[model samples]
Target: MPPFGQGVSVTLEHLFDPGAVAVVGASDTEGKVGYEAMANAVAFDGPVSPVNPSGSGTLFGEQFVGSVTDVDDDVDLALCCVPGPAVPEVVAACGEAGIGAAVVYASGFAEAGPDGEALQAETAAAAREGDVTLLGPNTSGFVVPARDLLCSFASGVADIPAGNTAVVAQSGGLAHVLAFLSRRQDRGVSAMVGLGNRATVGFAETVRYFDADDRTDAIVLHVEGTDDGRALLSACRESETPVVAYKVGQSDVGDFAASHTGALTGDHALYAAGFAQYGVPTVEASDRLLDAAAALGDSPDPDGPNVGVVTAQAGPGIIIADRIQRAGGRLPELADETRERVDDALRGVTYTGNPVDTGRPMPEFGDVVTAVAEDDNVDIVLVYELFEAALGFPVDALSGLAGRVDKPVLFATEGIEEDMAADRRALSAAGVPLFATPERAAEAAGVLARYAGLSDRREAPADD
Candidate 1:
């Protein structure tokens, strides 16, 4: 909408239009970029045309056009898998054909070295002159969950259900990993794009687009580095939608990182300061990306940094409580009213302070949850248990209690079996979130608290 790369103005409809698509350099060989791009397009359930001089007959049982001009239908996007030397010409043709976007999957671009930089520069110049929005010259491309569009080799494992989260990553591997993690958490994605070598459109543009997107309620980013930090930070600060970023390449890792993604490594301290200044929650670990997304999606704005721990077992509760404190979150002492409520509801042996442990075979686990939920100091409630027990605490009762409370409730179960799966599904259906481990649940709560605190602080008045 606003010139591409200026800010966050691109739209999913503009990016994933299925009116027509052309896969340049479509090949007959299996596992090649051309073949994978063509395979993804064929699986798209929309109109597609393969554009390659070598693909005159047909590929994947569809007719192949020798060139972009030969296709009678208007092309919305072009998947370019051509050689680096041929990219400019192919992009020029797509622009002449009025194609809005081109997803370049070629690798010998800026990531290759100095020669690659020159090639990448030419590619960017062609796109800018032709007015085509380029996705990547060294990328795995993007995917749209609602349209069932899998446009890259990395998206093969992405069987995403319709959901509100949109993920934009700089690494192709991380993008796929995020998608897989989201699926495991029962979280669906609206769209995912890997801005490899970011020749035309950058991560900030996608973030801004997701901010305005009706389908995208949350945005998750995996960034390596960016040439324009100010623009990226500004776009993120202005967006109403929440953003979670996981950055790599903070340390010098020999020549591997540069050759892998062309990311110019920078100081972690600088990146941390930048994130803090812009109110972007930066995650250090990969797993926390999904954790933060799940927690923020389900919870109300956290009122405080205090987390109330509830567990069937005392050991796991203590472990989680320790992790919460280690992550700079407070496990608040139960208020006088809360202690009285828990004492009245549970066995006398139950520790009635911060870590509210319902002693084994407790008669009133539900009432205990109700008491904790009512605590004025508690910003979030975390429950932990193993899946092997025959008679576990009533999760439905806990869900009901959580529903009544203004705070968010997260569960950490022990097993990965069908029983745990059933419990997760049931809790999720009741609007209570689930996590794999107590530590992960605690980490998620910490992130939620951090975001809430940052959001509460108002921005300084702008200069004229």
Candidate 2:
């Protein structure tokens, strides 16, 4: 938007891992937005500086300064929790203090009306003049679990565990929701950013930023609308980071999106096509978007859609196979050696043709998974099970098998109970994408297979 690097040279690292952060307009009052922001910032890894016009007291033993200029510290990030009208002034102060970034967590900007639009532009100008990056003029902020920087005012920001998946969303609420859901599933996030208003930094820049982030393994994007789909697609295409996008406004809600953040809801078909062309998968649901990203994070993309499944129970395996086909994936015939090895390992009557049915969870289940993983025809492996104390979830065996193989091996199970907590933790720690349902499993595999196919096409020698 500002010709790449014309201003705001500070990157997302400044926002996520700042040396010191100042909460502008901070309040000691409970249940207030500014207060909430300050409450969260107290957990930041670096020094948390509170800045208020009064600047007369302290919160959590940290003294409040009258203003950013008065802090006398190098503030890498500033959370501007003041009103939208005062954002320009707060930004000017932050610039004067040499702050690199600010999260203007206020609404009533361009999304409000013409007057608000003018205000949003003025705020951006203030940020640019100071060479500071702005997260939102009407947005939520960002959360980095690894750095313990909860710049966001979101409630669920506290308990998020650190992991490799990075989330980027247009809606602050949805960003937090994704982060919460991911954490709940044991697939914690590296960072969750809300590109509110996109006043200065937007999706493409953020995508590129996370692409370079060493902590991030996979990236998930939630897009409401965008002006330049091509640019976004190009950045994603050039990036080695596997991206999963969940773009809303596909069904005649352009007006609402435009009013929401002055965004242009680009044609959904073009977005779909662009993503597909660039080896990116688009999920239809928000939760599924995170699911896919989590799946891709640990599971390397399949070179083809030929999936081999191992089910502790027959029904779930069949369901997985059906869903995989419905999602435009394939189930190729297992190799003779593969089927024979799995058949020999079976201790009971089970189907060992394609989706190797184990009849029930057994210790030999790991061997079955290994047999499938070694198959030359099989590009992906899906393992399904019903968690039971008798079977013990096979954590050690599966964990060991996953490491032995080069291909992607995903685990899916039904049932959730406290008793299974240890097993879940063990598998997750070993870097397995465990889905709660067969549908989710298939959806994740679809992303894996689809992206794999696209990558294969891209690597193929072009027709001269």
Candidate 3:
């Protein structure tokens, strides 16, 4: 069922870091589609060759080629920003020019119905004949932050920082939005690709590419619907990197999905089953997509589901505990020795059993956390700290927990002071998944536990 390993001709690197890029249908006309695409591709550090049929003057001062074949320089990638009907010929030309990959930014493909479907078929045929990996026929282009390859017309390409998370979505707009939100949450991704019409490069293949990518540590995917179930599941199963999927389109798929990529609202139940069987944690909320990815990104890979909870204020602590259980996570009973140590650290002021409430912020906050993390029972830690001067949520002191215990600690709090912002940044930069609310912190903890358990099963997968 998974036909992915069958000798794919094009190396993903050509699509990712194509040494020389050619923007087809490029011009300087303001508010024009070609104009925006050219403006965006100009940001690429590699040589960007503008291609236009008019044979007119240069837009960005680079000499324009009347067609892709006319370019003297070697072109590995073709940004097919031409109209839908014209895309096939351009891709064919790129194939003749020995280009292995192209990013098709045109719409009016399958979403436009039969004619669009036919046109998309032609584009697919061209890709096959030329051994090209076409990214999209009706989608936004991709982005690689570390390379400064902002390969899209969408705005806000400059501010994106280089990090470990990677995003692949069916919708281009959603992918960009997720990338932007991830950045806002103080998390940056290694790559962002929009899989519009799966003419050649489908979702499963994209996932596989991310899995092999050295820069990516975690993968976040947005799925509307997919035609190949085994390929998707096989990609998930093969990926050593954890995959967090934001499965959109629950009830009504709406017009955008149908018109945009001809994708229908799939059976959510079946999709959930596949994800669960493969240990892929799926989030329903759009906002939590990146939150889960960021939480899972490059830190404290917990070995078990048993969580140790700590809080300065009791109310939020209780809230986190309840949510953890409700979210199918366990708050393990503190071991006898572990409980005694926690009690001694707190000095018997508050509840010291499982959710250790310190009865107001303590100077021994870091010590108590270390005790929980070191305990035999606890595999992860959920901590809630309010802003108390010097003692409240000490980022530096808590930073030691990740290295000491080798367990993820999700830190949650509210009431940020104007002064402690840098410390907050420091904590996140130190690999602590910071959340504005207790529930989100709980969710992150749950995801970590879920992944750990599933990963163990994956290691010794049950035979069919």
Candidate 4:
């Protein structure tokens, strides 16, 4: 395998927030990839110029240049929308033009056969010789929701709104999937990047960069595989910000993963173990990864593994308890005083223990939750309640309690989607994360407790 970025300066800032962007092979044709790249690049919060070796024409209000070097203004990033065989020259020309970075949207590199591998190595050499950072050879590109910057050619990705979470994935497709899922959850992302083919930049570099980024509160890493595990471990260990990882390639798909990203999917068990040792939580599914990162990012670090479950209905509450406990979370018995308070609030009509079941929505549902949230043994509170038009969400009560308490409180509910919109917004404004299902809420609560346990383990002194 050929080395990458020997002399190149890899500045993620240039890749993420470039001062100017050039879309090489830009086209005015609506259906062309070049056209889509141009359309998205124009939305960037900087000067966006189109570069085409063909005849120049006006598209998206920007005049096309014959070459990147021909452009009068300096370009910090170039979207190489050209073919694989054409990438090396593009990188060299971009370097000669003083462009700091370039994103290769072309495929058929290392992921392809031997000839493609040679092409990838050549592309890497050109990038290194040019001292330019490269993002991908098979990437769908990235999006910065806050800046309204769309560095990708993929559709629907441009609509992702800005939020506190940053998603970095090995697959551009998966990255966009998580972004859209976040949007569906009414929670968006700060930035979403795909490390496709990883011609130069990989997870370690991206993680370290996002760790120092103030815009990112939490990072969700989607790893298919990697050869440089130690670098990733160090980066995750150094991050004070919360990180949740989703590792794929669990089945007998190592060869497929290798063909996909040019990196062999190493032992999945080793990856999980190393991630745990480095204090980073790992999840298997994409939704779980997003939920964990969202909960950890928005909610306070939980103090312990004890979760207080307060449900308006018994069935969903039972489901939440099962999921949380299975994920290593504890539903501790409520303090006697706490149970008494819950009983008084619920009129002894339902179970008032750790997994407190309110039976149904009632006037004092908020008080029942408050008692559990304030319990001495409850370090995290998980509440599951179906929306009732008459009683509605306990927004005011939970918001007030969350404001005063230092623990994590998660709310899960199912209701008429349109009707719950306003309350959902209100809860979001209060810094409370609301899930659409009992299992999701419980999974998020379990993530909180797992993170807290990791912290405790890290802080504990070594055995004598």
Candidate 5:
């Protein structure tokens, strides 16, 4: 049997930085996929040629061609806005036109049934014959904010500015979900791609490509499942950049997941075990996936699973400590010297154990945090303090401490957005990720610890 889609070239640069694009099924009607695809494509930094046999005149400030072969300019990518039945022909036409890449926006193949699967096979065959790299037969396309490229039809994606995070999701909707969540959290992504149906491109190809991408610092994978899980695992294991994953279909959603993207979504427990063995940090919730990515991308990896937490309020600290311990992290007891220093700083005002709760945002809170972070036992530090305009964030102290320490220092706070905006930026600029919720911050810390443990296991010598 032919090796999976004949291993067609999925050169990400060509797909992402195409000099010019062709919309194979461009439409003039509002709300149509062709129109929206064209609408997004015109924002590209290069020329966009819309192709439709019946298309005429200009739409979205681009001239419409009768076919892909008719376009005079060299096109690197084609967005097949046509229906499922017409996609193979369009992909074949793109290959004939020397276009190296295409994104098929149509559904119906594979997930629909055996007939659809046959059609999907045909689509793949056409792509292989044409030497064309296909993105999807059922996908939402992709976005490269740094290049001012938005190939997806999804709105609000245009505003996701250039950043270091890269999202590789199996489902297009989930891709958008992570992108929008990142935007909402004021986090930007270098690129976000949806691997739909996987007629050609899948997790391994995309992950390996992004792993080498200089623009990407962290890669987040939203996995339902794949037949090529081993390849995906290999890519993750080989990636120099940090990779975080969120695998769904943990329950009886296997059929639903398969229908969504023709994924296997086999036993969730097996996937979890495989991911753990491969050293990829897996998150449970969708939002937490983005959270973990941002955290891992921005913060330094911990030396061990030992975390030192300093909270101004004991209640929230308890919540954070509980969640941290539950997530495979340890709040180890502070060293004797560390406890003494914290005691000296807090003046015995509150708990001085591993959590080191101060009861309130006291003046010496920063000093206590420093004491805990400086402790040799603590590999990571998590700080929580409510917004007290009077006390303000320990920006100067925390920034200085973070700069000095080799480990990660994460902050968790809740306050009026307007009031904390400047401090948030300051902390972020200092390489500290400030989460809005205690759970989110704690979870971020837990991921760092989890990854550290995974790394330890990976590097540990196997028993003879």
Candidate 6:
């Protein structure tokens, strides 16, 4: 059976099309969810109509309707920002009007108390009955960066840039934060979906969709909890797309058992075991999320465990090499040819062994990179440097070396301040990945190597 549901597949392109949109409960007041959504839609260069029973005219120079039933033109999406009690009725009207999807932004759902759960259930049932796909009952909604379309009420939409990685986050706030960080790091997003309470759609379905999405190169998930562990695991295991996840709600009770569902499923150990069994990588920190996305998105799967360390300084280089070894990455013995090249580049003062360190004030830094990168034993290369006034290391030359070499190169620099921002930008644009600390760089490399090893084994079902 196919991993996705039987409903019509919704593409990112379909979701962002500006030809048709309806904003329920749209208001002229600022800071309100409906008002913000309509304003964003208007700015998105799409056809949008505001629905408000109190008004008979247009909002933001577009026609206004009192109800979804009044809309004569085709609407691809209905952004419902109505109160929880009124959501079901509005959804039913949209279904009768043939609206394709409903982005329900109201809160009072399963995440709330029992009454909220009933309200969410009624809204979801209405969506099913109306044949409309519901995005959330308490969600920031979706954004398609390439299209410049934003349907979410998230205040941070102004910063996101269009790119290849798509994020599906369960926490509405974290979803917004992820989008902000992506933009801040210059990593673009193709699409973002915030699954609030997940009454109808689940994380597994989103993963299946992303696997088939041609624009998406990688997927990051922020999961709080889920109803069906086995089904989610199965979907991820079957997908060829790389899956990275961060699990929250680790303090909740009954987190490990199969019988536990919803908020009770917060056991960190059980989730870790499930992720390992299915070949899904689980990350803890937010900073690592960005690093993992960058590394996995660019580099090919590792061919072997061998890693080469190239540094302008001795201390940082030694630190990274030791960390790599501790993290399970091998530092193979340097080849004779490589050692000879290093010797010629460094003269006789510095050691030319594994973790090749060229002496300071070297005339040609590019040559040093080429020498270390060309080594036969190196599967991955870690470059560490410290930016200072007296030592003007050839960053461009190092980046050039990165381009020519087939192996993955990770760059780490000390003294990260506003002064080094330009150099960081240059290295980043040149496709030489940068990390703030040696430990983080090595940890990221270790994670990548571990995933590469797992990828070689026969894939297992997620629930196992």
Candidate ranking under lDDT, highest first, comes to 5, 4, 2, 3, 1, 6
Name the better of 4 and 6 by lDDT. 4
lDDT of each: 0.76, 0.83, 0.81, 0.86, 0.86, 0.73
Runs of candidate 4 exceeding 4 Å displacement = 1-9, 456-464
lDDT of 3 by residue, 150-257 (tens): 788887876787888899888888888888887877778899888887778877778878888899988998988876665677678778887988777777765766
Of the pair 1 and 4, which is ahead by lDDT? 4
Q: What 10-residue stretch in candidate 3 is worst by lDDT?
A: 1-10
lDDT of 6: 0.73
Residue pairs that clash (backbone atoms under 3 angstroms), model 3: none
Better of 1 and 5 by lDDT: 5
Q: Write the per-residue lDDT of candidate 2 for residues 249-306, one digit (tens) a residue.
A: 8799988887777686889888888788766788889779888888787876567887
RMSD of 1: 2.9
Q: What is the per-residue lDDT of model 1 for residues 1-464, given as tens digits with 9 covering 90 to 100?
A: 33334423343454565577888888989978888778877767577888887776789888989888788877788888888899998888887887878888888888898999999889888876777888888888888878767788653544766667788888777777777778866877877778888887887777778888888777888878776666677777777888888877677763676777776655667777877778877788777887887777666657778888877788888888888887667888889998888877764746888788775535577667777878888988887766654665466676666557777787777765765667667777776777888889988878877776677432533221
**Per-residue lDDT of 1-464 in model 5, one digit per residue for the tens?**
53453453567666877898998888999899998888888888888998888988898878879989999988999999899998888889989999999998899998889999999999999998998899988999999998878889887877887778999999999888888888888887889999899888888889888889988889999999888777777778778788999998888887788889987787888889988988898999978987888778877767888999999998899999999999889999899999888878877668989799899997888888888889999998999999898878988788857557778888989989999889888887776777889999899889999999999544544332
List of clashing residue pairs for candidate 2:
none
Q: What is the TM-score of each candidate against the true structure?
A: 0.91, 0.95, 0.94, 0.95, 0.95, 0.87
| Deviating ranges (above 4 Å) for candidate 6 | 1-19, 253-262, 326-328, 359-363, 388-405, 414-422, 457-464
Query: Could you tell me which residue pairs clash in candidate 4?
Result: none
Q: Alpha carbon lDDT of residue 184, candidate 3? A: 78
Q: What is the lDDT of residue 105 in candidate 6?
A: 85
lDDT of 2 at 390: 70
TM-score of 1: 0.91
The regions of model 2 sitting more than 4 angstroms off are 1-10, 456-464
Please say which candidate is ahead in lDDT: 3 or 6. 3
Stretches of candidate 5 exceeding 4 Å from the true structure: 1-5, 400-403, 457-464
